[model samples]
Target: MFKYDLKKTLSEKVFIFWSMIFPLALMSCFYWAFGGIYDIENSIDTRSVGVIYESDNEFATYFGDVLEQIASEEDAILSVSEVTDKAELYGLLEQSKIDGVYLVKEDSIEVLMNPKYSATDSMILKAFGNFYVREYDMIEDAVTSGNIGAVATILDGMNEDADYMSKEEGIFAQAPNPYLWYFYSTLVMGILFQAMSGIYIVEQLQADLGVRKVAMRTSVSPVPKSRLIVSVYLSRLLVALGISAVTIILMNRLFKVPVGNRLPQLILLVVAANMFAISMGEMFGLFFKGSMSSRSGKGTGVIMASVFLSGEMIATLPGVFERYAPIVNDINPATVLNFALYRLVYYEDLTTFYIEIAKIVLVTVVFLVIATMKLRRQKYASL
Candidate 1:
């Protein structure tokens, strides 16, 4: 009987589609759209900069060689464009042809930039200017002190400081990438897809509205309804966990997502998240089962609603709720699960990780118990 139930459940087209193909297909689309972005973001090395000189000025002429040297290398810090006219330089800055403008002076170099177009490149240009000024001051000091030997040591120390500044912060805790939010949302959406199996389970019951020939047979059989429900739960649980595992593997290997060093913890969170999704789905399924209406449309709506609240649909939805109706984040299963996984894989905060895990487990237990009670209470006038 168990084998028959398992086979029938797995054989359903909807089951196969939702449990496996949909996730892979969606992930493929995600990979195609966003896979190259990380590399592109990381490869940016040179910012376009325009250097305008006062014609016939010896100081500007002297700085031309410095700018050329800085920009001439294969992997240069700045791609320099020498502008002879102030009007032309302003045009380039306005059109964003140059990230920033450098005005060469006899004693100091001035930077001109349009705040509207300037971004990180502007900051890079400013840092470069700061370094040049520091080096100039050091050279002047060394010349005045008549200590050419100490100049080398001071420059070496400055170089060391620059090297330290260039080094990235700890592997995971560095600057946050906005692109990762979409990937994180995709994973959560895929896991939430597991709810489809739960809806299918509910639809199979004789008490529900759908064609229930199997449910009728099971009703008359000696095997209890509670036992059948448990089997359905287990089967879907395993399937959901399997799908999540596959998703994680593809995300890391195919998409080249940096999952970091928390593989074991990530795996545990995946399983726990799947459990929460399955049980939550069952809770909704059983509720809608009692209503005996079409479960698919309603189930899909529930799933979308969960994702929306979790900020899968809108990135700021959760944040908005957090500020105003903060408890919604705590109550929303999808938000809780997504946050738990995010914390586990990205933040690696043990305290929040364990807290989120406990919340999921508690919610799963509550939903499963409610669903079991609903199933146990079923009474058929005629089967």
Candidate 2:
């Protein structure tokens, strides 16, 4: 029965088109449109600093030259521009064009920073301030080593083991994995929609198109319902898989966004999450049976639940609602999926990773079993 059903679905061109072609098309369009749009650029750190020191006085001349040298260096992250007067810096501050400003007077440096600026942005002011004071650190180190060429060797070593540097030294890597919070949110949403496609596919076959044919005995005898559903589900599964593959590829190629886990582990999690979503969708369709005639509103309910639980609204939703509401992020499948992915990447401990993956797989399996059972019990009249 299973083979016959499978063979029947394999022959259907539309199933292949929907499950593979259409989904690939959507994936391509989505990744292209939004791939570069999503990234973890600490543009906060890109904040430019205004230097209002004059280039005339001896101290000012030396300090200003040192500031430009540091800012121009590739390793130094800040962008600097000279300001003729304090009033100019103050005016730009009001406009918020730059994050902060500095006045390098003879006695001490005065920093005017926006209160709303992030800690890391403020670090630019502090770091450069120290560099302005300790301009001879590099010269001293070079002289102590008795070799000017040794600075390159020192820098090369720093680049290799930058993370292991002492607490005083900071490590700069690609902005932490951009996908940590919202990656799973997007993944879960995509999974749900893909599964819903299968549910609709089933309806198209039996409820909408097959209704009259099934009532006709001559037409009904040649076709088995199980074979039809399986065929459609297989097609939808391909589509679901295609969407996932394309997203991963786009993230890697375009954004260079790190997903943390090995490629294989990520694929496994994506497939597992998709399976659960497909199963839940199957149950919804089976329970409702016919959307055109039944008008059960179950499909609408599914979308509504997902919207609330997807974490997009979690911030606006009150704490009480988030805690107790069934559709809140804490209880939503999207949140759970994202949490698992985050742990897999961020948490170095394997035990926590395994626990989260197990939870998601458990939920998925339960949904799949229940959905299959529900569909098996459905009553379809002969055409």
Candidate 3:
């Protein structure tokens, strides 16, 4: 089977390239360029803070706009909110809506409310505050000291840079970076397992070798047909895990991503998910005959359904997404793995984790049962 699958197989080499080489190459690049740059964090003495403006001072408005832009970027996350009045802002603070606030005045800005927010972020926020002061002072110096009168001389003679306030504050905390694994579990895990599982199913259904082995070997060998199918299915499950394990290691070792505590559990989730997917593939395969033509349609359907229903793609889809979201997300094992990993790593909240684990197991059982039914009862021409 290995030699035959390797020889005429159009996709085998493609999968090998994607599973091994692509991840190693991509991750090595990230490790060198990004690893050190991200390590620099502000100290506890200074705070990086987000500023919000209600009526909007000139300095306040400018900083607020910059904050919004920076927040959208990867390096910084500025949580800023604008309201009509102080009353509204205060209400938000009381409700723990905003992490911290910067109230901009005519001369200076103030950080009001939450102190638990990262000290570095708060310092950066307050650095914006000092920036306003320095700019105002520079303009004041030019006007009052008559530097503006001799502006050309000052510009020509001054060789030193601006003496801006130093950035010396950072929130000192330990938060695991879950972005890498979450990205892996959500996107890569889903597509790879699905395609492999579905393709394996297709292979089994169409191959005369599989039929001959099963029909001839199982019936007389004292092994139950159910056990025979389970054994075959288990082999495929191990193969999927083998691929996933290598991919995960390459990603982690090269990129040095913090995948979180109980990494073994996450691997368990990966194994169980691939098994479920293989079982699903087996069930789907029963629909196709020896020609293997039907596998494409089924494969396409599975891919579409998995990606579409995955909450990661569209994100929001009204009530069906939020209310029945877990169910919808369950339609894609990748989503299950992602949400589970998110909980395990970042959220550290266990309620949702247990539920997702249960759902994964349930889905696996259903698919396995369906595959067994198809294998035992379905009528088909010999391959």
Best by TM-score: 1
Error of 1 at 344 (Å): 1.1
For 229-262, candidate 1 gives per-residue lDDT tens digits of 8888787777677777777787777766555466
lDDT of 3 by residue, 1-383 (tens): 44333342335554445445654554555456545644322221222343545446665666566566655666454545555466776677677676566776776767674655443344444545565555555655786777765655454433332221233211112121223432443335343434545455535543342533544443455545565565556555655666777766656555555455566677766766676666666655666554344664665576556645543333333124435444565556655666565555433235666787788788879877776766653334663
Distance from true position, residue 12, model 3, in Å? 5.2
Each candidate's number of clashing pairs is: 0, 5, 17
Better of 2 and 3 by lDDT: 2
Residue 118 deviation, candidate 2, in Å?
7.7
Better by TM-score, candidate 3 or 1: 1
Model 3 scores what on Cα lDDT? 0.52
In candidate 1, how many clashes are counted?
0
The regions of model 3 sitting more than 4 angstroms off are 1-182, 185-195, 198-202, 205-224, 288-290, 308-320, 323-327, 377-383
Residue 300 of candidate 1: its Cα lDDT? Answer: 75
Please, what are the lDDT tens digits per residue for candidate 2 over residues 1-383? 44544454456554345434553454455456655644344422355778886435655666667667667877566677566567888888878887788777774466778766543455446555654444344545676879767766655643442211121321111122222234444445556555555455444454433334432332245556455556656665656676667765655455444466456777777887767667666656666655433422565467546645554334223234444563454456665566556545443334545665687788777876665554433355632
Return whichever of 1 and 3 wins on lDDT: 1
Best by lDDT: 1
